[model samples]
Target: MAKEHSLDLIAIGRSCADLYGQQTGGRLEDMLSFAKYVGGSPTNTAVGAARLGLRTGLLTRVGEDHFGRFIGEQLAREGVSTQGVIADPQRLTALAFLGIRDPDTFPLVFYRENCADMALCVEDVDPAFIRSAGAVLISGTHLSQPQVFEASLQACRIAREAGARVIFDVDYRPVLWGLAGRDRGDDRFVAHEGVTARLQEALPLCDLIVGTEEEIHILGGTTDTLAALRAIRARTDACLVCKRGAAGCSVFAAAIPARLDDGLTGRGFAVEVFNVLGAGDAFMAGFLRGWLRGEPLEVCSDWANACGAIVVSRHGCAPAMPTWVELQAFLRGGDRPFRLREDAALEQLHWATTRSGRYDELMVLAVDHRSQFEELCRQTGADPARLPAFKALALRAVDRVAGGDPRFGVLLDGRYGMRALEAAADHPYWIGRPIELPGSCPLAFEGSADVATELASWPYNHVVKCLVLCHPDDADELRERQERQLLRLHDAARKTRHELLLEIIASRNGQIDDHTVSRAMQRLYDLGLRPDWWKLEPSDSAAAWRNIERTIAANDPHCRGVVLLGLSAPEEELAASFRAAAQVPIVKGFAVGRTIFADAAEQWLAGRIDDAGAIDDLAARFAALVEAWRAARTHGAPADREIA
Candidate 1:
């Protein structure tokens, strides 16, 4: 193998929030809601390359505001290095409000009058950072202005000096360059001599150049496609690639040919186009995946076309780009005119592969018991209204225990834990909100039964947790109903891109044995319900734990590990359970709710303890359990450790 570089690519340009209208086939004004995603050509390409398993980085500036921070965090989660991502205190992040009116017509408005990303200047380019990458990608959109243009040139200059490849994406948008109205951000091309002149200044420095037919026209300073290719070919010897929409793309490694199609080319996929906004970026990403690996040009075209085909069929750009696993699966093709968004298997792979927060050991606090909280209030003659604040207090205990580690998750409910959920929106901790109506036997969603819509209203940090008391020995009718509800919830989680943590209690119906839980898991996996996490009762022996692990590994190796449910067991009883699961790697940690918080909550409710006392009690108990779990993981649970 060749000596490796510190990074495969570093994309330089804008990174902002793209608010795509939730309701497609409508006007932007009439659209009620939008799904925000990390966008901007350079960042999109960076994210795409990262998803394709490339070691990528981004050099851009975003405001210190919420959206700006969101872009930074999102890039990091996508596995793109944010070392060059600067937090601009002076300017706010950019936003693009867009709507798909029809298959052909779309409306876009850029909110970048003085956005932070546009402030990228020559000073932001780090020569060492540029040299660390095998290649640097410069988006043409950054060439529209003086500051960003200089930054792009500085990056390109440094890349060439270091013998690193430079990739130029002729990502032309007339509105960005003032050739069109500010609102006409969707306008792909405007014939301007100055824009072409600006692009030409950086052409000699690039190793590979990519653009659409219209984009190439803008760069070549001509209306005719062939003439434009020839004109641009004269300025530099960089390999040219012209994106030809549904015709795939054409490559020119030697010289401009009489017919663009006469060059080495690959045909586009026969998939229906949903939106053309980010296909070019996806194409760039796919191309780089192979190019950086020294793969042949034909293979690169194959990847680029497949990536473009997949993204154009989806809603947003960055999120729609397929990971390496997803791309390879799509390349194995099932049928023509692919409906990628509706391909459940592919979409599932996308979710499984691209998601973050893979904790080495997850220690969750399961405080999402709605009826249990209400029952505690009822027994103590306390107002149910007070439960919300108590739930917040319980979350505070979790916060106190976690100290901002993402491994410490909280299974909360919007019914009473809304304050906690909303407050922890930006918290590093993993927050799971329950969807199952409390103690519902057959399992029903908490609100409106419209699980998808309910999930959509939830914050991105919230994972959808559903507890079902399903037994392997259930009657036919009951089993079918339970499976149906689970399937519904499963699909809803997929559509909303929410991670699912399924808690199954098999003893709910019949006599329990070690294999019963494994059987229930097998049934769910057979039904194609692959949850991100599993909350299961602790196994009494290592053999039972082995069965559980085999069942999970056989069905879905991507299954995020499991956590043991407390089931209101006493702290002493739970210690033994934790000891049994100590050798089982699948059992990440415990989500013991009542064991940790129930006593304190009851004390607070019955007025036996004040708020400070109750909070201290809860925090102490939670902290003890965490320590016990860690000890068990490290050196096995001590048999003589006294209960708290």
Candidate 2:
């Protein structure tokens, strides 16, 4: 087949045979009934871009086996030009087994060894075809192997030399590199060292770099979005784009000569997500479409966010992507309401809780409380008829706090031999479960003894600190103990090479002492320990800034980074202080928590919390806060520059 003259996009990479299964139960061992689907980043991007009304072509090498035929048929069905895809008789097609265990966790197992995709050589990609395309989209996974790496880089160089814009998606997969014989040692899968090295080589030649916040962090070794952006911009002139699932996307461009907006501004649009599997590809497709149409960067981001929102509401990758018309309709209309039955919602919550590392059986006790409350309402003294109204009020309370509604609720007019026909509500014990917030690393406990072990056990990449409830009167003592414990834990973690985290409740203490901090740092150094990052309650005091600076200077080479949690500090001073201290490059990133949990707890404790409405509000607010923090970091003056 001959190549087309002018293509909107030339997506070059792997085409895999996919095996998919939907989870019947929340447990990992639960028997799952699954269905097969076509999967691969390159194929998905081509299909996604085509569905968004682009004339897209795919350039890859596939086996002459049944999987290859399937890939060809799927691409043709999706309207992607596949003339450039080559069929290799020497190798078998790559295969991937995908399991959607629940909304938050999806596990994938790949069987790719000397696959046809890796068989692609420089000759397989046509120089003239790449030159004819408006943009060339390359996946980072393919670059793990030496043969494909060289070939893909050659294609990127050819496209660049031809004046074509190149888009690089840093889809880092440690397994893929391992298959290529790269020994990463202890930092094997999680660190993604090989992929980062490859990205460094390709990034300088590309016009755009598209990656998730996690991917960027892995490549740049920082969770701060702006730091990641600056790191990439420092190496290349590509328009840097960082994808924040559900919250939105950010675009950073260098200050050009006489360009409008200077491309340093950041913006976000809200999104409702259902299945986040291929949302990134959808965003890339939408962004490319907008960029091709000469739209503003902000509008491109909005379109990308809209497209991602549309896909997450549906199931699967290619099947979920909306056509250009559907995307337009969705944009014209408001947010799509989630259509979930009560049973479905319950099942989802159950699945979410089970897979969420944050919540264990002990922490999630609301189900039992609801059952007990029902029995109490059935007693003789209770007015059974008033139970319904009272239950409604109690339900409102559960809606007020973080993870409150789905995991808890209230019942009214319980009999329990009471003379008055009154309603009752109870606070449920909270089990902290790991949550993967958009645009940040998976959170872990600050003072955890086995950080790596705990991180491995976590279902997702990020870990948030568990709530530490200390009595107001004992706050000072608790703070002191926590500081002492943190020092000991830091020493222990260094010996074990585990990441240490220390989370202190700001509302409990009202303030932190320098003595405690000094002792903590001294102990950290004594044990040869440095944290990946520390999450502290934001403060404006000179002491806090000084502590941060000193800590970063001391642990510059050893620590991953430091992040200031909670958005209570003055933004101007915080930024200024961060920049001044960021003189050391190893002081990688910064972040702030939204205070959603605090706000929700305050409402629940104050008797103003609503059960039914709280969960969604909390999630939305949390997502919004993360979006704002990321935006500020992206657009904030360089960490070395003082705030004006």
Model 2 segments beyond 4 Å from truth? 1-5, 24-32, 179-189, 192-194, 255-272, 339-644
lDDT of 2 by residue, 102-146 (tens): 566656667777888888887787887788887788888888777
Please write out the lDDT profile of model 1 over residues 430-510, one tens digit for every residue. 888889888888888889758888998887768888889989989989899989999999888877779999999887688
Please report how far candidate 2 places residue 68 from its true position, in Å. Answer: 1.1
Worst 10 residues of 1 by lDDT: 335-344
TM-score for all predictions? 0.95, 0.49
Q: What is the RMSD, in Å, between candidate 1 and the native fold over all Cα? A: 2.1
Candidate 1 lDDT score relative to the true structure: 0.87
Q: Pick the lDDT winner.
A: 1
**Candidate models: Cα lDDT each:** 0.87, 0.56
